[model samples]
Target: MSLLADVDFRRYWLARMVSLTGSLVTYVALPVLIYSVTGSSLWTAFVVVAEGVPYLCFGLFAGALADRLDRRRVMVIADLVNAVVLGSIPAAWAFGVLTAPHVLVVAFLTQILFVFFDAANFGALPALVGRARIAAANSAVHGGGTVLEIIVPGLAGVLITLTAPAPLLLVDAVSFAVSALLVRAIATPLQTGVPGPPGGMLRDIREGVVFLSRHSIVRTQTVIGCLQSMTGGAFMGQFVPWLDQTLGIRPTNDARLGIMYGVWGAGGIVAAVLFPRLSRRLGEPRVTLWFLPLSALAGLACGLATNWVVAAAMLGLWAIVYSMVVLTAITLRQRVTPDRLQSRVNTAGRMISFGVGWPVGALLGGLVSEATDPRTAIIWTAAMTGIGVVFAWLSPLRRLAGEPIPDADETPTPAQREPVPAPDRIEA
Candidate 1:
């Protein structure tokens, strides 16, 4: 069946899209609020630091907990928590008691909640869709959000100026509430069985790590995924300045910048729509092996292009290749992982890929851009992705290329058997 034709998936897709669109508004608004309130670049930098710290600190625990609890219940409670906290920004602003620290605290709190929400969500999607449609389901959810990402950031910028950043976050609060309702409305099971008393949290987390570290394809894809996130973060970090430095499109040129962003988003949209097909035809391993080099080449091309036209096209192509690598790695991890370990294992990997890799890459790219020019920095980061390509060629992933995905039955293994009986498949 077509993914959208499935009633619960349709609701699930809309819930994710709605939450993403709202957050995109906050993404711009929160920074604007901080700057307007504190007027300190250091405080502004704290916002970025605050967002990443929660992911690193709480990511694994959230995942471990999700696996032991009812995932959908966890998601719903998280959304409600997010709604109250996010709504606080506007509430404080209305009473004229808003401060920079208040906004910053809200920023940190919201992100912490996101770590939990996202952990539960990672598990919930696979449970809702089942294994057969995992790739397509992932694409549909990401594709919808990518489309919003293209449209909403620009609109959020405009809305910030018009409605003020503080008032605008209410939209985010409302979105979270709506998301909670939608998630609750789903008629399908979000887990295979009701969770029993979990073992030691540390022990549960260890099991996830040992499994990830031992499984070759899953391990290889995750390591490559970390590398991709790092370099991709580094590459994008220098993107704006590279445009100004190479093609003479200054930061103030919104029309040209908007078009460039739209072009990049279009590339993401194309990749998201096509990745499932690519995975089916080429297999996930081959897709990653083939595309890793293309991403590096495309990144290098963008760095080399002095003309705006060439730069734009290369950036679009780079986005496609780059996004596909990330998506395929995620799909591979989810496909191999048992449902019981889905949240813990996937979140553990993300803690490395996103929590650690992204911030580090941005910091490294910034340092490079400082030492040299943005153009040179872009080239350096592009070259960095070649590390992933080389590793792919040497790793077990290379041999797995062109092989079909294993059946779902083959996925659940004796290696990590739980004492819990076969799941009764009840709604949480």
Candidate 2:
């Protein structure tokens, strides 16, 4: 049965799509606003840091709590909070009080809320669609976002000329408001279980950690996800500066910058359309092994290209393989993880992959860009792709010639179940 026919999944998908459409536009505008004001790659990198730091601090807690509470309520409340906070951006801009520091603060707070929302969201998908349909559902959810990325950013690029990026955030604020409504409208319960008596948040966190650590496939891919995000962070941090410095595309009003980023959306489309086909033929693990090496090469080419058109083209190819690697790895983890552990395991993995990896890469890229040049920094960061390839080859993922993926819905009886690993106590 098609997941589209499922009411809960459809509403969930719509809520997500609406939020992504707005966010993608803001994604382009935020950097443009930061760079136009601060004129420093390091400051731009700070935005990436702000986006990640909250996840580092609250990611575990959010995940633990989400498992215990109503997924729908947590998600809806988070969206409402985000809507209000994001609305403040345009308010500040209207009052002529906007500053880079204000932007950073908002960015930090926004992500903090998202970490909570994200914890619930990570669990919601598998609960709604089941593990068997994950690949197709993911493709649809992300592909719809990609299609918007292609259209909205290019339009946003042109829109930048007509207004300040700060005001554009109002659109994001509205999108969040709409998403909350849609999520609230879903009738089907998004959780399989409410879980029995409280284990306490710390213990709950430990349970998630224990499950992820004991599972070989999940652990290996968590590291791979980090490497991939690092590669992403570095390239993203340097890109604005690279475009501005090399191609004379100013952040204030350059359609070229928007058009360039939109091209990545086109690449994402290629990935979305191609992933299921490739996974069916090549199998999941092998897909990453082969495609990522080419992405590394493409990323390197992005740094070396002299012309804007060539650089954009290289970035598009890089985006395709990069997105594919991420989708494959994420599905593998979700497929292995049981429904109860979904939020905790996924959040921990993302905290490491996105929170830690992205910030570190961006910070390093910023430092490198400050010391040398954006192009040099880009080349250095792009090396993370190659490094990830090495990690994948060394991990157990490489030798699985025909091992079947885990069944997420499978629950062994107590007598049949192997003794699972216990929680490793986290020391303060």
Candidate 3:
């Protein structure tokens, strides 16, 4: 059967699209809700910090859980949990129980569940689609989700005008429920190839870390990823306030940020769709090497912008290149890692890279933006991201263009097993 004809894939894709649209709605509504309650930029930053901190704290544990349990069940549970939590916001508001503290608590809770959902979703993909199709499958998912990014903000804007942001939370809740049902309908068990370590969760976590540290490619990729995320986080955390304060554009009035994000999502979708063929042509590593610098330049451009239009355009460029870089990175990681260790390794990578760096960078950005000019903060962040381009150019990963990926049919040779370490531990 044609890949497009795969029943499970179709069901899962449809579900994700529906849920993503709703998520887009909340992404807009939540901020608006928070801003309406407290008209302070610091509170806005606090909300951002609240959302990011939990992911940093729980990312590794969530990944280990994905490795140990049925990923599908985990995903379903996460979706349902999110649905219920998000669904409560509107109800609370209607009952006059909603407050700034309530919004903060709900935002924190929703993000925590989101991290689990995200980890399980990635962990489950290999089992559902098989390793060979990972790039294409991921591309399709990213592409479909991008399409929604373009539409959802406008939809949310319309909804917000007609009703309070509370009712929009119900839409998010419904989306999650639908996603859960669709995920549950898939009958295929996610094939976890082998268990990593037998002892406690600590041991299992340690083994995963040791494995990643030992792998040169994984180690380098993780380091670069971390740097990229740190810089990206700093920029994103500041961009809203920067635009609002420096450009004299209010967040609600200027939907250009949403447009910029949609453009970025479009870039990612385009990269994902074209990556397989591009990898075949330019070679995966070479493509990354070429694009890495371009992405940095895009960041630099975003920093230097003085006008809203220029800033939005620069952000769009950055979004496009950044999407390509991420798609390539994820594809390479998925291709190289063994099936059994994929979740552990992916989690470890994220834990060290994005999970850790995002909050730190964002917190720093918030502080810096408050202390100095937001544009200055953005420029520094952009400069830092550009510096990573030199590292990429010097690494052996740069020379890996057109190299043939190992055939999946080959069995993985047994490597020395390391003792499991404690949970939430990260190395390299």
Candidate 4:
């Protein structure tokens, strides 16, 4: 069946698009709200910290909980929690009691909820779509989001100009509520029958860690993913400064900067459109091996481009290659993991790659730019992605370059196995 024809997947796709569009608004609006309230860049910076810290703190635990409980319920509860927490912002504003501290706390709490929401969501898609269609499904979903991303920020910026930022969050709060209802409507059996770890949450987490360690493809890709995130973080961290130094562009030139980034997003949309077909022709392993290195080269070109047109073209290329690498890695991870371990393992990988890698790379990039030239920093940061090529060669993923994906109907062995009756089949 075509993915869009699946009722459950349609609901899931709609939920993601709605939530992401709303999130685009909140992403711009929240900082605006914080800045308006405090007039302090320091407090505005704290919101970024608040948003990140929760992912680091709660990511693994959230993954374990998602695996242990009913994933659907976990997602629903998380959405509702986010709705209430975010809804409180407008409520406080209405009461004339809103403060920077309140917004920061809300930001932190909502991110913690997102950890749970995402951990559940990472696993939920594979269950809904089946392994064979994972690539196409992910592509379609990301493609839709990429298109909206291009438009949503501009719209959000206009909305913020005309209305208060606090009320903008109400839109996000309502999106979460709608997402919850849509998720609750899915009839798929999201929970795996693999027996729970006997010890505790830590044990469950350890099991995920061990699986990630032993699984050659996941380990290689996870490390590569971290490096990719670091490179991306560094490039983006230094982007504005590099543009100013290299092209005489300033933040005031919002149109030019927006176009550059929009071009990058356009590349991502193209990658999403092509991913499934590319996976079919080259196979997942070759796609990974080739795309990682290609993205590094593309990043270098982007850093060195002197003309706006050339820079946009290079940035677009980098985005396309980099996004393809990411999509391939995620599809591979989802395909190989067992149902029970999916959330725990995937979320653990994300915590390592995203939570830790991005901030570190961004900080390092900023330091390099401050110590030297922004162009040098951009080139150095972009070049660091080449390390992924070396890592991929040494790991098991190299074996997959020409390999077909494993049978979709098969289940991988969990780290620990108990002798038990077979579980009932759950339709995708």
Which one is best on TM-score? 2
Task: State model 4's lDDT.
Answer: 0.78
lDDT of 2 by residue, 1-428 (tens): 37778888889989999999888878888888898889889999888888887888888888888888888999999999999998998999999999999999999999999999999988888888877788898898878889998999888888889988899999999999999999999987778997436668888898888777766677778888888888788878877898888767777666787789889999998999999888878888888788879878999899988898888889899889889988887877777777787889889999889988888888999999999988888888888778888988887677663555546656422322335534542110
Evaluated at residue 253, the lDDT of candidate 1 is 22
Best by lDDT: 2
Residue 207 error for model 3, in Å? 1.7
Candidate 1 has its poorest 10 consecutive residues by lDDT at 419-428
Question: If scored against the real structure, what TM-score would every candidate get?
Answer: 0.85, 0.94, 0.88, 0.84
lDDT of 4 by residue, 134-237 (tens): 88999989899888767775666666656788988998999999999999999977664643554599978887877777666777788998898878767765
Model 2: how far is 166 from its true place, Å?
0.7
What digit string (tens of lDDT, one per residue) describes model 3 on residues 105-217? 88889889887877777667777888788878877887888778767766676666667877788989999999999999987776566433434777666767776786545
Order of candidate numbers by TM-score, starting with the best: 2, 3, 1, 4
Off by over 4 Å in 2: 195-199, 411-428
The global C-alpha lDDT for each of the candidates, from Candidate 1 onward, is: 0.78, 0.84, 0.73, 0.78
Candidate 1 pairs with clashing backbones: none
Candidate 3 clashing pairs? 202-421, 203-420, 203-421, 206-421, 283-402
Worst 10 residues of 4 by lDDT: 419-428
Per-model tally of clashing residue pairs: 0, 0, 5, 0
Q: Which residue pairs overlap in candidate 2's backbone?
A: none
